[model samples]
Target chain A: MRFLHTADWHLGRLFHARSLLEDQAHVLDQFVALVRDVRPDAVLIAGDVYDRAVPPPEAVALLDDVLARIVVDAGVPVVMIAGNHDSAHRLGFGARLMAAQGLHVAGRTGPQASCVTLHDAHGEVRIYALPYAEPAAVRDALGLDLPSHEAALQAQLAAIRATHPPGVRAVAVAHAFVVGGAVSESERPLSVGGSGAVAAEVFAGFDFVALGHLHRPQTIGERVHYSGSLLKYSLSEAEHMKSVSLVEIDGAGQVTIEPIALQPLRNLRVLQGELATLLAQGMDDARRDDYIYAVLSDTGALLDPMARLRQVYPNALAMERTVLARSGQASAAGRQLRELDTGTLFANFFREVADADLDGDQRRTLDDLLADMAAAERESA
Target chain B: MRFLHTADWHLGRLFHARSLLEDQAHVLDQFVALVRDVRPDAVLIAGDVYDRAVPPPEAVALLDDVLARIVVDAGVPVVMIAGNHDSAHRLGFGARLMAAQGLHVAGRTGPQASCVTLHDAHGEVRIYALPYAEPAAVRDALGLDLPSHEAALQAQLAAIRATHPPGVRAVAVAHAFVVGGAVSESERPLSVGGSGAVAAEVFAGFDFVALGHLHRPQTIGERVHYSGSLLKYSLSEAEHMKSVSLVEIDGAGQVTIEPIALQPLRNLRVLQGELATLLAQGMDDARRDDYIYAVLSDTGALLDPMARLRQVYPNALAMERTVLARSGQASAAGRQLRELDTGTLFANFFREVADADLDGDQRRTLDDLLADMAAAERESA
Candidate 1:
């Protein structure tokens, strides 16, 4: 049985306060094209279908369009689950009714209702959908005293195992922070204020475990893997090669997985260099449209560098002064104090406090204030 | 063919800054029960399924549950359309896919696609869902130069009639404000800066015209009827008797309409009396839980009457001083000016400007300021 295993679409996610709806739409268009070409037995979306519990209308429209294109037009069956970020009750709205139309969404976890059986040339393969739930919810659902994610997962797996018929191959889909998995800055903590990781060993019995909640694509155990988020949601995930997993299980229950990369409309990139060189390079850079976080190494005070940089790289979302960090030492500070003028010092201070460079009007106001103060000092003397 | 016709649900509406989600749910639960008991061939939600285009998650969940119950659980089909308040693009998502599931939603108006045919003992009843659209959209869709709502509806009817098979009964489900229909404050004007009303004659040739947009349930023409909003969305609609229409069409295309009144969890009411008498009556009133808009007739100075009224009428939402309006006349104004104290004058001014009466602390501060002013006057004298 072959299926496309993907998760963490995070539709309607904002990067550095900039909306990624258009970016997400661009990649999903490619995803639909892939589904049309690949024509897998089913498409399994593990979890985190939306970035928030109540996604924007555009996000809802995008999901609806993409799902319609895949399930209705392409005739591919899709199985999805709700992640920690999703409101289970809201997402699960038409799960039962839409199931007949080949769109299976498990917004809330249940022992019997979570399992969806699909048949390929091999035979019936049960896909157990374990939506993200709090420990308290899990405890209530299972009537178990599971206090941690590990225990909750274990209890869930036990329920699935008890319901499974012997010799039937099964695939487990989950959205949890598994042990030893790399964390990303964009991921919301599963628990409010406690450890929320589940052991990789908890998922050992399943033939293939497809996971979500981490933005980096990696395997936690031999058969368990995270397909990761569709796009790099954080600057920390700049190096992540975002992709979905194509899983194929043989008639004997053997599994093989392949990572299929998705090309984004704009790549998330972190650029580090001197301000002048970066600006010069940005003028001719092919990836100038990429979402950029600039780290400037210039030691001298700069005036409205972001405004200047945006002229070349309009998508530059953030910036930091590497020189400021390196100049934290007393010697560097003393040298800088000796070299810089009052206006520059005030500008720097203003930028540090307000997170913005002074505009032309503000600069003139400051100059007038300083002149008035100096004149008063001279008169008093 | 028998069907349950309803419109202007306005789900997730807020009345007097108070959320009516629970109230909406209560009525919809009754709506679902009615559908189950009626066992109609189809449940026709003419338009305005949601109060807004981008509804809250709870609203989405509510709509989902209601549709699931009616279509999936009760084994009935539902035909819904987008109203002026809805985001057509968002509401239309997964329309084609969900059509197979018996939940037909026409969010955008189109020539051929808007028509949904359902069979009954009588014959095929083609439902032409003309979702709320401006003149421009109607013109664009029909390739006509319709400049007004009347012209737009005529053009749409022409298109639907052109393709519709002769001798078949057709129902036009629209969300347009028909001329001669009673207007209410809660109904949003269909157009931004133009006359948005369409003549009832534009719906000619249809067996029955199920309409929405007006919050008052009334008949516009011989066969055209509005079911009104599910609940009173504005104080102006306090007298509206909200209900849904049960339509029965015979083999000869003759129609019979019955209005089934829906009992709201809390009725919207406007009360007028002296503040003391109103509060005293509210203590013995069985329907004190009703949403009350109080019009106080007391001529004397009162302190936070609304706060005091809530002790008996917990759902009292708004208050108006009718005495102030009566006192607008010259004689009454002279009497009020002569009788009112300085504190009362200031309090009235504060309430008029700030939309809130001064709290105890504020009143104390005002008194202290007045005392200080008096002391300064004495010192000057």
Candidate 2:
């Protein structure tokens, strides 16, 4: 069974308050073309199809257009789930009706997660598409005492396993953070204090596990994979080679994965240099229209450097002054504040305020006062 | 052929700054039950499924639940179109894919309006569903000089007629204000200066024309009908008999129309009389939960009347003081200002400002100045 696996489209996302719809549309056009070229039997979108619970209208339109092209024009069945970022109910609208047209979208998690079965020359492959659900929701639906993500995921997997026929191969598509998968800044944390992580071994019996919620593509277990986001959503992801995965499963359940690179409309690039040098480089930069995050290394204050850089690199999204981010000086000041004795620090402050050193008599009086304060503290303790 | 026709749901609407989702859900529950009882061949929604371009998530969920019940549970095909208030692109998402499952939604206008054909014991009945399109969009798509609603409708009708078969019975579903249709304050004017009005004669050729955009349930020509909105959306529509239409067409194209009334959970009511009287009446009112718009007729000031009324009638939405309105006094003042001569009005104003009447010499001088001003006005004219 062959399929195209992708996740974290994050449609309607904004980088530095700039809309990414145009860039998303550009890459999705290629995605549609790839479907036409490869003609995969099914398309698996793991989750995080939108960046927000309530996305902008243009984002809805883009998703509509691309899905129509893939499902209607290309005639490929698509199985999708909802990630944490999606409003499950909103995304799942018309799910039952749309499934008749071979667009299987699992927007809400149930006791039995939505299962889409496809057949190849080898046999039948049952794909379990489980939408992202918190532990409370999972507990409510399944009537279990699942206290964490790992327990919730295990219960869901167990339910799927119980329903499986003895010899049939199964595949699971989920949106979760596996313990070993790489993450990026753009991926919203599923829980506070990192309690959202799930174990890869929970998906042991599945032939292949497709995951989302982490924006960097990686493999955790031998068969578990993250297809990553379609584009670089943040400057922290500047080094990501964003792509979708094409997976081929054999009759014996052996998997062969090929990463298909995507060309973004505007590549997210980070540049570090003095303002003048960066401006000079932009004069001949062919990819000047790329989303640029600049780090100015020049010392002292600069006059509207961001506005200046934007004149040349029209897509410069953000900038920061390295001089203002003087980590060494800040740490030194913190150390001095932490280590200084109270009386000595007060004397130093008095000298600065009065513009004169404490006299010997005043110093002795201060010392005597400090000794009395220490005795009082001892008594209170 | 029998079908249920309804429009102007206005989901996610707020009445007097209060959410109407509960009210909508209550009425729609009855609508779903009616569909189950009637068992029509198809359900037709003319337009305005939502109140705004983007409805709230709960509204989306409600629509989804209702559609699922009607299409999936009741096993009825639904034909709907976009109204002016809907974002066409957002509403039309997955339209083609959904069509395969007997849910046909026309969200965008093209060279030809969308046609969905349903069969009966008699034969094929073609429903031409035209979405709401502006004059500019109609002009651009059809390459015609459509300057108003009338012209646009004529052009769209011509396009549909050209492709329609000769002997087949046709029904046209549209969202437009037909000539002479009664309107309410809640119904947004389609255009400035009432240019959105389309002549009923434009739809003369069709066997039946299902109309929307006017929230009053009424029949225009022999075959033209509006089912009205599902519920009263404004205080001005307090007396409206909200219902959906059930139409049965015979083999010879004769039509029988039945208006099926919907019962809202909380009826919108207007109360008149003093605030204390209204509050006293609420003691014995069994329907205190109904939405209330109070008209307080007390001559003097009242203290926090709405707050006091809400203690008994919890759903009191708005209140107004009729004594403060003083329309008669305002008009009398306006008449006095308009009809009084400039010199006399000036003298009256001087008396009020200076606490004394103008002297004889001052009046004579003011009269001379007024004469000079009149002469200057005559010269300018």
Best by lDDT: 2
lDDT of 1 by residue, A289-368 (tens): 99998888898889999998889899999888877767665534653465454667799999999999999999878866
Which segments of candidate 2 are over 4 A away from where they belong? Answer: A143-146, A193-195, A272-288, A295-314, A318-381, B193-195, B271-289, B294-381
DockQ for candidate 1: 0.27
lDDT of 2 at A167: 74
The pairs that clash in candidate 1 are none
In model 2, state the lDDT of residue A214.
85
Model 2 Cα lDDT, one tens digit per residue, B58-150: 888899889989988999999999888887777887888888888899887888888999888888999999888777678988899987888
Interface RMSD of each: 18.3, 15.3
On TM-score, the candidate that comes out on top is 2
RMSD after Cα superposition, model 1: 14.2
lDDT, residue B346, model 1 = 88
Q: Ten-residue segment with the worst summed lDDT in candidate 1 chain B?
A: B372-381
DockQ-derived CAPRI band for the predicted complex in model 2: acceptable
State the lDDT of candidate 1 residue by residue for B1-381, as single tens digits. 888888888877887789899999999999999999999988888788888766766787788889999988999998888887777766776677778889888876675547778887777999878888766667777788986788888888887888889999999888888888888777766643234777888877899988888889888767898888888987768888888889999988898989899898999898999998998888889898999988888888999898999888899998878777766665446534644545667888999999999998998788667545533432221
The candidate 1 chain A region of ten consecutive residues with least summed lDDT is A372-381
TM, every model: 0.79, 0.80
Worst 10 residues of 2 chain A by lDDT: A372-381
